[model samples]
Target: MKNTKAMRHSGPSAELEAKGLHRLAGERVLLDNISLSVHGGDRIAIVGPTGSGKSLLLRSLAMLDPIDAGEVQWRGESVHGRDIPRFRSQVIYLQQRPALVEGTVEENLRQPYFLRAHRDKHFDRERVSRLLSSLGRGDSFLSQHQRDLSGGESQLTALLRAVQLDPAILLLDEPTAALDSDSTAMVERLVIDWLSEMPSDRATVWVTHDDEQSRRISNAMLQIHDGKLSKDVHERIR
Candidate 1:
C-alpha cells in the first residue's frame, strides 16, 4: 500500500525544502535551480548517472557544502547561524566512505557524543550492542579495530553510529556501494529496521544507482540529470 500522507495532493507542508538551489563550477552549473521537498515518512531515492550531481545535491540538502545560491529550510525555518549545528544534529549525513577513528570501533562510536553538539547525549553501550546484534554482529565486534573491519563491516559500524544518534533525517549517499550483495542486503535490512522503529518521525534520502534497490527502499523517486531534477518520476508500487 502507498503512504497516503506522502502522496497527498494537499494539506501538510514539507519537512525540508531547498528553494532555487544553484551551484556553479566556474562556467559550468553543477546543481541548477534544484528545488524539492521532503515530508515526514518520506523515503526518497535520488537516481541518475554518475557525475550527475546527486551527491552534490545531497550535500547541499545537508547544508554541509555551501550553496552558491538558494536556501535550505527545516520545518519552514532557514538553517543558519546557531541553527547550523543543531540542524546538523537532527539532519545527519553519511557518506559512502565513512572515516573511522584510530582506535577501536567502540571508541570511534563513543567519540561523537563527546562533540559539542552531542555532549548532552551519552553513549549507550547496551543499545548499541543490540543494534549491532540486529545486523549480525556481536559485542566483541565493537572492540575490533577499524583496520580489521571489511568494507561491509565499516559501513555497518558507521550506520550503527548514525542510528544511535537518532537523527530525524538521514542523508545516505551510496552507503552500500562498496559492499557485496550479502552486505548490501544486510545494510538494507538495517535501514528498514531503523526506519520502522520511528516510522512517523524519521525519514531517509538514499542515493543509489541500482533501480531495484531504489524501488525496494524508497516510496518516492527523484531523477537528477545535467544539474536539473526531473519532476515526472514515480514508481507505482500499489
Candidate 2:
C-alpha cells in the first residue's frame, strides 16, 4: 500500500519523505510501497511487533540497505548508491547491538577521527569527557577494554562516540534495550539533552518497542506493521 501522506517533492518543508519505497530479501518482501515524511527536528519513535520491518526502514534511511524500488528524498534530493557514503556519514546508524571494536573506549572514540575528514584535527578530550560524564560514566572508562564493559557501558560509549562525531541525524535501534534502569535513565537523559542543545536541522529516529521509553525521548510516534508505516501520532496528549 502506498502512503497517501508521502510528500511528492521535498523543499524547505521540514519533512523527510519517501515515495513508493520497497525492499526484499530473496522472495521475502521486507517493505512494500512504504512512504512517510519525517520533519526536521522530529524525534520519531518507530514501534511495532517483531518482524515488522522497523529496523529495515531505519537501515534504509541510514543508506545501509539498498532499496529495490522507489526513492528516499532528503530536502528534494534522491539518496542513491554514490550518495550513500555521504548520507551515512551525515546520518549515523546505531545497530541493535553496539558494534564496538576490540579496544579501549578512548581508542573507539578516536577511530572516526582517523578518517580522512578529521585526520588532521586533534581529538577533543574535553568534549569526549563531558559526554561520558553526562552519561554517568567516568574518565577511567577511557582506558577500560571494550570486551570488559557491560552491555549498558558499551552502549553509552558507542553513543558518546557518535555524538563526538556529530552527525546530522541519529538512527538508533533499541539503544537502551539491554540497559539497567539507572543506565537507561542516564542514556535517556543524554539523548534529551543532545536533542535540546542541537540545532533544528538535526534529527533522531529511535526504533524501540518500549512505550515508556518512547514517551520519554520522542515528540512523535510512527508505527510499522506488516512491512508498512501504520500512522503518525503526536506523543504529547493534546
Candidate 3:
C-alpha cells in the first residue's frame, strides 16, 4: 500500500502547473481534465500500465504535444505561442528512447546552444566533462559516435544533454525503460544527484512502470488510469 498523496509540499508558488487539461484521440478521450501542480522541491512519480495515457500526461505538461483543452502555466504565467521555445528551455522533456542525431555526443550536446532561444547560453566543455565524469565516464565519452554507443550510453548522453541546460522542471517518460539494471541505476543516480544540487528550485516528474523505482524516485505518487488522474495513490510502496 503506497501513499500517493503523502507529499510534503513547498509553500506558495509552484514551478509548473496544468489546469483542466484534456486531449482527444478520434472519439475517445486520451486525457480527461487532468491537472497537477509541481512546485519547487517536489518529486512526483506517474505510474500506470501501458496504453493508460501516462506518456500523454507528461507530453501535455511539457507542451511538446498540444492539448485539445486546458492550460500549462509556469510560475503562475500561462505559456503561449511565442513563449513555447523559452518555456521548453526552462522545462525540459526527455523521452524513454534516445533521439540523438548522427555524430559525436559532443556535437549533439552543442546543438541546443545554437538554438535561437538558447543563443544566450554558451557550451562549456569542462562542465560537460564534469557531468560525464560523475556518471563514471571520462571526457572521452564525448568523442564517442552517437550510433556507436550502447543503449545505456545513449540514454546517459541524452540525460547529459538535458542537464547542461539546467531546466527547472524535468518531465521524464520512462527514461530507463530500455536500459538494463546497472544502466538504469546509473540514470537514476545521475538524475537524483542533479536534483539534489538545486533541491529548493528544481523538481522532476518521473514516469516509471517499476513500482520500486517510483517509490525511490518520488516523494509523492500519481496514478493515471483510463485517462483519469488519481492525486493520492493509496497503494503501499514496496
Candidate 4:
C-alpha cells in the first residue's frame, strides 16, 4: 500500500502525517495499510483493547519498528532511516512507562539539553519549576532522586520534560496508565491545557485504553481491532 498524497490540508498545515502504515512480525500482522492525515492542532486518540495493535501502530509511526510494508511521510517527503532521528526530535514519543536515569529530577530533565540541538541553548530553570508545579509536583522535586520517586511522580516529570522539547507532534502511549486517579487527571489536564495554549498547528496522537481519558482529550478517535483500523469515529461520544 502506498499513499500518493501523504498529507491533506484545508489551509496551512504541518508536515506530520502517517501514510500507508503496514507492519508484520514474523507471520503476525501488526498493522494493515493504515493511513492518517494529521493537520496542525489535531488531537487524535487511538483506543482499543489489548493486543489490538494500537501500540504497534504508534511504534511504526514513530519509526521505531521497521515496516514490512508502507512508509511515513513528513512534509510530503518519505522519511527513511537517515531522517528518523531528526524527525523524532520534532515528533517525540513518550512511552507509558518512562525510564528515568539515576539522578535528580533536575538532572534527568536537563539530559536533553546535552544533545547537540540544545547544547548551546540555556536551560530554563524557571520553566522546569513551573511545569513541575503544574503537574502537582513542587520545586523540591528537582532535588529528589529519580529512583525514589513514585510512578506518578516520575511520569509527571517525564511528561513535563518532553513537552518542553517543543516537538511538532507527540506520540504518547498510555501516558497515564500507571497513575492514580488524581495523578492521571493532572497529567490529562496538563496535556489538554498545553495543547490548547500552543499554536494550533501542533498534533498529538495518544494511545490509551482509558475511554474517559480518550474522550476528554481527543477531537478524533481511531479504533484498532485485530491489527486493522476499524474506520475513523467522528463523534467523540458513544
Q: Number of the top candidate by lDDT? A: 3
lDDT of 1 by residue, 1-238 (tens): 0222234422177778788889999999999888877776888899999999999999999998887899999988988878888888888899999788888999989988988889999999999888878877889999999999999988888888888888988999999998899989888998889999988778889999999999999988888898888766644342
The clash count of every prediction, one per candidate, is 0, 0, 6, 0
TM-score of 1: 0.93
- Rank by TM-score, descending? 3, 1, 4, 2
- 85-187 in candidate 4: lDDT tens per residue? 7788778889999888889988888898888665656568998777667666678889999989889888877887788787778899998988899889887
Per-model TM values vs. the true structure: 0.93, 0.88, 0.94, 0.90
Taken over the whole model, the C-alpha lDDT of each candidate is 0.85, 0.77, 0.87, 0.78
Clashing pairs in 1: none
Model 4 ranges off by over 4 Å: 1-11, 236-238
lDDT of 2 by residue, 161-181 (tens): 787776767889999888899
Write the number of the candidate with greater TM-score, choosing between 2 and 3. Answer: 3
Over the stretch 1-238, how does candidate 3's per-residue lDDT look in tens digits?
A: 1222354558586678788889999999999888788888888889998999999999999998988999999988999999999999999999999899889999999999988978999899998887778778898889889989999999988998898898998999999998999999889988998998999789899999998899898877888998888656623342
Could you tell me how far off, in angstroms, the CA of residue 128 lies in candidate 3 after the best superposition?
1.6
Residue pairs in collision within model 3: 1-235, 1-236, 2-235, 2-236, 2-237, 4-233
Clashing pairs in 4: none
Global CA lDDT computed for model 4 = 0.78
